[model samples]
Target: MRISLALLFAVVLQLPAENGYAQRTHVAISMNNVSVEQILNKIEETSDYVFFYNDKTIQKNRIVSVRNKSGKILDILDDIFKGTDITYTVVDKQIILSTNKMQLVQQEGQIQVKGVVKDAGGDPLIGVNVKVKDSTVGTITDINGNFSLQAKKGDVLEVSYVGYATKTVRVQNAQVLNIVLTEDTEVLNEVVVTALGIKKEAKSLSYNVQQVSNDEITRIADANFVNNLNGKVAGVTINSSSAGVGGSSRVVMRGTKSLNGNNNALYVVDGIPMSDMSAASTQPTDSYEGAGQSGDPISGLNPEDIESISVLSGPSAAALYGSAAANGVVMITTKKGREGRTSVSISNNTTFSAPLVLPEFQNTYGQTEVGSYYSWGSKLNTPSSYDPKDFFQTGVNVTNAASLSTGTDKNQTYLSLGTTNANGIIHNNDYERYNVTVRNVAKMLKDKLTLDLSFMLSSVKEQNMTSQGLYYNPLVPLYLFPAGDDFSKVQAYQRYDSERNLLTQYWPYSTSLALQNPYWITEHIKIPNHKNRYMATASAKYDFADWINVTARAKMDRNNERRERMYDAGTNTLFASKYGYYSKSNIENQQIYGELLLNINKYFVDNTLNLTANVGANFENNDYQSDYFGGKLKSVANLFTFGNVDTSEKNLANQYGYHLKKRAIFGSAQIGYKSMAYLDVTARNDWSSTFKGTNTGSFFYPSIGLSGIITDIFRCSTDIMPYMKVRVSYSEVGNSPDVFLAIPTYALVDGV
Candidate 1:
């Protein structure tokens, strides 16, 4: 009968292709009130299903009301497991849930691993951490040093960081890892940081703290990086200021403990406290026709946003920062935000300077009086071509910087921008600056709280700023020209005076009027200086255990300055007066600070004694103001205003204001033994509203320290004497009495 009817049509097409995953795939459902794990994620989003269970055996937060418009997802999971003793099994596309009928499996020695964490010069070492050994399971490498975790193979990971050296491996099957570490050179030669930002260790430090780093302050790009720390610390001196390219530098650490107070130093950045108060022409007296050293306040920072620069050189390493460390303490440490994955850095610096010496002048003399400023005249036939190196000019310094760092692993960020332009071998003498910095770091609860916020902005503009003695200094008329004149014929210093309708001075030698007309005192004897600064900081830390911690910080630093000088009316009569001489001044400085710290770290005999403690409190407020009006220009020319000047009394206008408040309470303690002998102590108390009620208005500072490790007490041989330590300390810091000394002040006479 036709071959048995084709064998019953091939057994009915192989019986629905072997059961089609035990049938029942169609699934269309409508949800309401969700949860039964959202109806098993809406029946595994409508089809090829996948549900598994035992997140504590089903009951995925119950609550399910479903309507199956087209179902066969086992009839909507049998109306979502009817009386709910939960139980399901589909296997082929997975839907093996369980509750009473138990059957859910998936958990066999987890395994996901992945890694990277370099540093023995191979770079990449962002936050490190990487746990897994001993449980709480961890993670931290991002920002390029990658990482991911889930341990299994044989477990045991534990990488760490902070000066490195702390690693362990073993995760056999290897899903990817690369650690490197190494460099705990004895914990980086015994830590450091000190004075309030407190970190101690060099055998418990008893004084001499140095440390520079940030690759020694950007190696050698100095626009006043505290003059690059002169000889690199050892009593730290510095000096620097001939007013070239944004001047003012004066460090002085151990030697100058304040004779008349403020011997520089004291400029802590990250831990706040800043204000090298300068700008009173940076005080080096003998005013050469006015306004010179207007640079300080650490010459507007920005050493690529630093990252280290300690130097608490004395007062036993700055007796807890009281009285602004009394003349010791440079601190600094900026650049934060690391936990990685977003980074960009760019830098450029170009420098070319001249005149390393220049000052042996004597073009064989010439000019015994022909409009002479005496180069002692006479004997000059060929030597009088007069070349003080043709009056200098070949200084160029450019700097550009950019930075951005990104993070994750609980937030992080850091940004930076910098620009600088200089030129000064004197010809218009310029210097410009702009910088911006921002920082943010966050790590909430689980990380035990940590927050840091920062902002800094700076702008500076300078031009023709050089005032140190001879009338608005143009190197005092280019070194008293007249070696035989012809300095390129006055470089056209100005000429247009149909009888004083404007522009005059064309050089004719005046000598003692402090020589002017060095190209008309750099074109019109002007001096423009501008400064704008703002700093803000906020900090928070909270550990609450694991040896306790608590930190709180607040900071605000503000600055505004404007200084101007313009002398016109035929210049140099000790700075133009025939109705032309103008001066403008406005200086403002503000500081607000707040601190609270409490830190402790314990460990006893078993760990062989170790203590470490710190308690702090601080509050500071400072405000300074200066305003001045200038004289003479009641109209003889460049009409600069104080409303055109000329306010009598020989016209000298001035005003000043200052306010200060300081409060403190500090403490510190350190003890160590097995870590190789040490002891330290600190205490501070200060009050001063410049001595509010006498008895020196409250001051008490103390510091004590002792250390020993003469080759770890002779157990020596760190591969043939690696380090030997010894220290001793004693300190008592203090300094107060300056602004209006003890109040009762007066001066402003005529203006009154």
Candidate 2:
């Protein structure tokens, strides 16, 4: 156990790959009956090479046939254009394609264009893509960020690099150019997503916050994306359920905070809180009965649609969210459209799962007597051949996902679809899910008013999710089977009883554990679950001025679930009668959230001081309902239905629901001095329906923090420490009492 935890921590602390492009990498291509344009795009997808060609000069419709495996780029290019007028030139990782016939016409106005690309910090950027706006004339920056290309005067130059914003400029008669590209804040490591999806500099924050990029989350795919976060974040613990694939995961930050209340961290998606719509967790009380796990609402979100995740492990970092974030917060930012060329990405991932370790079993021992449950017997000349591990099988998980992003400066859209089909190591344990998402952003009113809208749909089906308990768990009987018996005979786990005229369990052994054939438990006793959900969101922000703006947002999420458990005839008397047992439940949950914010930013004392503030009001309503019915069968031996429930026996019928509402007003202020130090303060007051009819229903919480840059305060050399800061904060948070704790309630007897 200690070794496992140490390994987990090691992975979380490792640094991510900072550089994406590698020079002189081998290329592989195999294609027949495809267009030249298709081949060019394929090369770009498989390697770091980008192809630039003029639509008029190159024959994009020409059919091409080529097969190369790990061959040099120059060799493959020579083979591809040997007999045609097409010519290719390789400059670093960029490929320029053109026809010899166009060179004669180009000499009329073509001139040598020379330029250097640098970052905002004056550092030269290598491998930056530089191209003419509408032609194939382009080249990549070589060592020292210098590039030379052929272009005419007045032609536009486009400069682009990963993690930096793209820039364009029109060339003049002068043949020299110097371009500086600024880093995109959205992709910067120093930028953090704060409460209400506000962007802030990490150095200015006074609390602990960790950001996990989308690449890191999807590095190791799982049915539930949360499982991929197990060893990726500091101060957070993620544990997958024992219920096999697509099961719920417990995510806790800073350890358990309450003895009776929920310790799980709150999940916020795109600035809206997501409700916990998972089934109630179950535990074996006396080893006679236990239930399987149901997937959580957060798992329904497609991982391919996520852009990033931020972890707020301390109360000071989540105080703006009021009582809901008392434990901690996990903020999920989804992908959105961007201004650029239309792009499509598709990926397929397959992974297998198996038991990491198994207990050693003795094959020399034999059962003391016939039909014995334990292998406490004398040694045998011929060792038993029974092996419990044979009951386990390799699990398979496959996921296919695709996404499309495109738009102009005025409007952008993003669409994605994903599907997962998986089976657990235990037989009859399986899970399948499908997801679709659409998002769009538009600018209107002279770029002052911005509108954003998104929608999502998800469907899931799961069966026989295995749990780590004695009851209904195949592992129990498989491991406890007596070695002396003929285990192969029990492979046929069911048989027709002549007297009862119905199928019955085949196992003849009986003991205190009430063990049945392992195969019978997996094939006969069953549990199935299904869920469908949809969410919609819309928001509008208008820039009244450069330093002030007002925004309004609203979202609705609805989920429906159906779960069932069925036991075949001749099962254990503790859970089922001679007839049979069946249980069914239907649950519906919904959450509606709306918010309005007033944002302000100003500079004071000739830019010596800066102040940023936000005042907001928000409301949320949650409605939940569930219906359940279950009982043992009456006269019909194998028929399982509500009408066939035995009237003389104690049956189960339940109907319960809850409606909770919360409203809050919040404000935050940040004051900065010369970009060196900052002071932050926030306050929120919440009114809850759980405490209705009492003044105590209203509660307030506030937090204050201060941070200062060490290098700036002491005037130390930045070369030794480019960024260093010390911070301290104090905060107070309130946890809303469980619903109905302050209200009167009654107990029901015999379903009255």
> Which candidate number has the best lDDT?
2
Error of 2 at 62 (Å): 60
lDDT of 1 by residue, 1-752 (tens): 01122322443455454236535467777777757776775565556665544445556767878888866676777787898787554434644545553233234545456668877535465446689888988866643477766666788898976566888998875335778888675445335577767655555565688677676667667666778778878878887766677777788876886565668877888777786485354653355454465456767878998877888878877888876777888888787766657779999888888888767777887888787777776787778666666677898888889999888778888999998888878777788888999999898986779899989899989877675666666776677677866777677777788866776777766555666667777767777888999998999999875567899999898999888878778876655676678888888988898999999876564446778888988888989888877876765477787777767637476678778888888888888776668788889898878786566768889888888778857877487666678888888877777766676765555447
**C-alpha lDDT (0 to 100) for residue 410 of candidate 2:** 88
Q: Write down the TM-score of every candidate.
A: 0.32, 0.74
Residue pairs in candidate 2 whose N, alpha carbon or C atoms collide under 3 angstroms: none
Model 2 segments more than 4 A misplaced: 1-188, 278-288, 360-386, 482-486, 693-695, 717-721
List, residue by residue over 336-391, the lDDT tens digit for candidate 2.
Answer: 87676688999998999998887777788888777777788988889888877788
